[model samples]
Target: MSFHYETPLVDQSELAQARAVMGAGMARILGYFREDGARSIRAIEEAFTQGNAAAMVIPAHTLKGESLQFGARRLGGIAESIEQTARRCVEQRLAPSEVGGEVAMLRGCFNETLALLESAAPPSGTPRPPMPGLAGTRPVTFGTAPRTFGRRTG
Candidate 1:
């Protein structure tokens, strides 16, 4: 049997809600990145690099939730690993060596996921669909930036 991957994030209805929310914040979304998404990723990487597990966990959790909401399954999966590892380290006080291994794993996962997301193409021969209810609204594009819409607490 061929196996298929399923995303753990939003369903179609939830996605619609997420899109509506994101549309409302379209003007401020890019600015949220500060450095066009690079800064946020760097901050997350540095937190992991420094062994600040709590910080790493928080950022990863936030990124994962947002990514899932926006249909970014691969990125969300990578972030989920980071979050899980960080949580293990922080909550269970895992050994430094274990945490180091976890960090390395997360880095690899993130890189691979990023590569896949970057290479993904829009469905061939299909025109891009218009955003629901966004007619006449200024179109906002993130270009190559990875983004998602979802709730984040804290």
Candidate 2:
């Protein structure tokens, strides 16, 4: 079955912020996935399979944070669930199957997110003007307040 994502996973306004932060370094940002995303995904999956809940949680959380910063809404949404599940597992000693399910869901989410990002045209030669509320902003910090409308801040 297809994974169902919560609404507002990606906000168009956030895309503007991401483009502004990249500031002609868009290629470099996308390159991270081309180079190391696969490895990171594998590591996350491996951690989940091994029942290393903490490891799974850590990577998922990192991915979620990064994805949101980059305005990768789809990826961020999936990773958020994985992060939550991992957290729950760590806190309450959940079953391995539960973690496994979350990991599987995460894999699908990654694939879809990657596809969506790839399909989008790269940032234009002349960077578009930053969106309102995002102009003159600094790069987003991990686990900080969400910067877009329709998304939970903090």
Best by lDDT: 2
Name model 1 segments beyond 4 Å from true. 1-37, 95-154
lDDT of 2 by residue, 1-154 (tens): 4354554545667766676666656666667864555666787888876877777777777787877876777677667777787788788887445656556766666666666655553655756557568768897768655568785655
What lDDT is reached at residue 54 by model 2? 77
- The alpha-carbon lDDT assigned to residue 104 of candidate 1 equals 46
Report how far off residue 51 is in candidate 1 (Å): 1.7
Instruction: For model 1, name the residue pairs that clash.
Output: 70-149
Candidate 2 residues lying further than 4 Å off, grouped into runs, are: 1-3, 6-9, 121-154
**Candidate 1 per-residue C-alpha lDDT over 23-100 given as tens digits, one digit per residue, 9 for 90 to 100:** 545334423422323444566678766767777777777767755654556556666766787788788766323344
lDDT of each: 0.53, 0.68
Q: Which stretch of 10 consecutive residues in model 2 shows the poorest summed lDDT?
A: 1-10
Best by TM-score: 2
Q: Using Cα atoms with residue i matched to residue i, what is each candidate's TM-score against the true structure?
A: 0.47, 0.67
Q: Estimate the lDDT of model 2.
A: 0.68
